[model samples]
Target: MTGSNRPAVSSGWGNLLSGANLVRSLALSGGVALHAVNLYISTTILPSVVREIGGFDYYAWNTTLFVIASILGAALSSPLLARAGPRGSYVAAVLGFIAGTLVCAAANTMEIMLAGRFVQGFGGGILLALAYAMVRRVFAEPLWPRALALLSSMWGIATLLGPAVGGVFAELGFWRGAFLFLIPAASLVALASLFVLPPRVEKRTESKPLPIVQLALLTLAVFAASWGGMGANLSSTVVGMVTALGLVGLVIVTERKSRHRLLPAGKFELPTALGSLYMASALLAVTVTCTEIFLPLFLQELHGRSPMEAGYIAAVMSAGWTAAAIYGSGLKGDRRTSAVRAGPVLSLASMATLAAVMPWTGADGDWLPLALICTALVTGGAGVGLAYPHLSAMILHLAPQGEEDKAASSIMTVQLCATAFGAAIAGLAVNLAGASSTPDDMDAANAARWLFVTVAVAPITCLVVMNTVSFKGADHAS
Candidate 1:
């Protein structure tokens, strides 16, 4: 794949008109929606199921194990897709997913249920990353943006409807019913995938072992993020956080010295096109994933709303995301860059408003809880919707020649990790707030406030890097 082969609208028909493109698009879109609904449904059931199964003693592992497996699966996607190709990979993932579903459907013990969720997450992570990577190879350049937008839109819709849909099923005593039906959905997607995804080009630029060390670093980072949510102490959490940073540093050094770089050689040495793309993508994912993780909990716990209400509120978030994504896609010039730049500020401000008003809507009852939640949802959701796909597209565009899949998978890995990070922070805040913490109110607002401060800080690093760093051949066009 030459530089010209990279996506930049060259066709009158665009890739969107092709038969294979449409089929793959639907398959990818549907597959993602299925997995998302499954997850949301499972989560809705968990809060209710804990009493029937056991107490909080074994509860945290439900999320913890799933996230850990997801990280590992995402890290392995490039390798898996490379070896299996899209057809074989999707088939194998779906089959594995079926097995996990069965485990959950028949789960008599909490351990078995958690294990099923872990495997489910692994399949989900691989499916998402590989699907994004497959888009570059299978579709035409000009149409990639629209295709990505479709994919992102799929996410917003799934998130909006998933919990509510799940709640309906869960309330019907069919929490397991969701996954039972998944067998057919996965089967259909697998069958359809074989017909659409293009064959691999079979090019060998360099054969390198998967970057095991960097993979370890990311795994550790994911662990720290999840562990922190388990209510580990400040000092221990701080150490875990630092360890994650250290692992990241080690990955940089290792990638710099190695022949085959996992995260792109340009991710090191900073300020080149590679670093810019990475920063933009990582930040975009950081905000969006964080928003999705917290919104459900916030609406349900803080506002005394049911899962259905929370799901409806989640749609508002999706509306902001979709509207902003559509707006960002058409804009030219600074509109593009500024949206990326301002994303963090908007996210931070929303968090600020959320923290300030949280007490008013606490368990004691104050003003209109529903209205305040909608406002918070719109602000943060819009900020994320505004930025995620645009940044994602830019990152994919900057991928090294012939390595678009790696770039996509790598970006998804960052997102998966960051999502767990944000959720971990939220989980920790809730646990530390203790049993007295009421659904309407809790003192954990201060902890939440501090975490928001950290989340807000994520993007400001881009500004610092832009000003302070230099690379051999990067030109900042804006």
Candidate 2:
């Protein structure tokens, strides 16, 4: 992957926003936004969901199963797009999403809702990856950066809207309506893709078969951890962690020998640049997921804040992430290196701050403590923002020739796996810290402390792991 094969950065956003490019960009970006928003919207609505559906024991499974299914979906995207072409794949994905959302909206039990979520994840994952996959397919080389930026912006847009939409519906005692709301927007994306996206995309013959065994192992790992957390017992938790770790080890071993690899070559070698970058990204994602999945619940349950307020506070981290990413993209040379190193440092500081402040009681009215919490969340997010793009770029720099696409797509898979594992581990920490106790009890406070403290290891370790990967020769262009 030389610099010439790389897509040129757009001189301005002007070309991407006019004529056919505008519509194509919108169709791709809209799909990503829909997927991203759906991810967070469920977080806001899950408490209401559990209340209505009686799935308190399976709370973490919401994210766990969805993410696992997403890994499958993302893995299948290349082949699906090849066989179905852009239009066919887009329509199919949208239909799957719509059907799943309908099932969720109509579900009467947690089991039924989770089933719906699986279908939605399968579809949403395709849509998310497709947004990136289509960038080279649909746009001129010079416009790639603006196209990529537009797609990236969707996550930020989702952050702003997802929680608010879910919170509004939850507050109104119409949590089901939140799922329903996604259906129409998705339908519009389908319609837009039908007209706007090229009917036929060039299909690659090198599409690999799905690594079913590896996927199964990854799924089992997540299931083990989630099941352990649900057990809410020390023995079960430890057993589950060990089992999950065992499965993960099998995944690594299998990836090394598999014909179709889930990760790029040499990723298993930790001391190498590619290996270190992948590890750093995975660890960063784990830390981020811990905060995203559980923070709102903590704020609401512990501080007596309204659902809307708690949701917004949780969004503070995402706000920081989006802002810093955009700000960091313009950086170069020494500043970029500084930002990369500063990321984990800030992340560690935020987690430590959260451990101290999150466990406290009766400070809700002070406003100062709440402000501090938001600042901590933002700083933690900022840390990831500063480094993520650089880490991503380094992956491209190190990807084995002819395997760049696999390498790029695998980044999402690695991140999703980390998220699933993180959520399960966070659940375990919460349970161990006494999440079963009432929110006002000391046990619940202990749970908050444990959750933040445990997740902080991800960043602390990330700092050390990333330091070995020298990014001095990175291609900073799109």
Candidate 3:
């Protein structure tokens, strides 16, 4: 259903922060916070997990499977919300998350850990989608922007607390405790949601039919890529990657022809402005997943940093994103367009810098390489931050008149799909470099180098594709 077309009231952040709105705000944002924090926590503790369970080969699979399951959960969110209502949906999601966390805490094998992650991701995805979906339902029109900003800020908070909590547990050689730690927090959020959120939406619209075939195709594509990465030889990797590419193409074609759509019209056509924005967003998202999925491992292995140090260092990227997005949000006219174009340039430079320096085994007591790594991480993340807000705004403004909601929802879907694929590709790179099978320093170094180099292509491709995205009418939208 589309949002109300009524003109927004002239309300400010104060309006959203006072009275009953305050409780509603906390309830909604808390759901997103749980999901975001869990994601960062998993990333921080993954290296420690592999060390104990000995499945370095499937390291990236943790992220890949989680994200794929998340996509499915997100796709099902609307139906769940319509059937179960906000309080019920929130409680159900929390139960799933708690179950998954318990399984993770008890897991003795990498396979079991992966299964837990998949379940956790499904719950997290539903929580995330519900938070965003409920905003339009619960908040006044004037409060939408403020509510969204508050929700988005949860990721920034996650960056701080997630690493600290997960890192401490990993440092203490009790990585499983990190998973268990989430249980109480999630329970509290669920309790708050049950009390604060409405049992049902005032206006219940029928949920649209799911794009099951397209989603299945997308999932297969990621699995195919991951499978190839796990293969013993280059030929197998080639065959797997090619097969994945074919499946992706089929997904696009199927979406184009299908009555049940995943994205708005023209989203798959690069010549269209909406299509270009989606492509640029997807490409930037890929760079993010590629870096985040492996950064902690690289830092711990290559720099001999402790888990706490590596986790904190990895979080610099999220800090940069939060800072830059706040700054970029205030830009206007030519300045905004410039920020959009500059995003890829900075990302390209950061990726190249990472490729060059990440492989180096620095001298004892030297901190220069680490400094450069952090700088590159910040720049890479800033690249996305500067461009993403504007891109999203433009997509909303330019979407087919009747399909704005579809366009809005598809943005998150596209991001999750790209993240899943990026993780799979990164696993392939690390495996091909032989880093997963061996503990050799050089192999790890080579894996770091090749991974950065491979993901560098995303920004380079974004650079070329972004230029075609015209800003002629974009300013009006902003």
Report the lDDT tens digits of candidate 1 across residue range 84-118: 77777776777777777789877777988888988
Candidate with best TM-score? 2
RMSD to the true structure for each prediction, in A, is: 3.9, 3.0, 3.4
TM-score of each: 0.85, 0.89, 0.85
Selected candidate, larger TM-score, 1 vs 2: 2
Each model's lDDT comes to 0.66, 0.78, 0.79
User: Clashes in candidate 3: how many?
Assistant: 0
Task: For candidate 3, write residues 1-478 as lDDT tens digits.
Answer: 2224535554466777788778888888888888888988888788899988888878867877888888877766766776787789878988898888898889899999989999998998888777766765666654554565566567767989988888889889999999999988888888888787788855666777888898798889878887786655779889888999999999999989998776678989887788889889879868876787788788888899886678778878877776777667556689979988888888888889998998886899988999999999999888877877667656666768655555655666777778777777887788777445555544788888889899998888888888777787644332
State the lDDT at 211 in candidate 1: 78
Q: Candidate 1: RMSD over Cα atoms?
A: 3.9
lDDT of 2 by residue, 32-75 (tens): 88788898789879989999879898886787778888878776
lDDT at 377 for candidate 3? 90
Per-model clash counts, in order, read 4, 0, 0
Evaluate residue 386 in candidate 2 and report its C-alpha lDDT on the 0 to 100 scale: 75
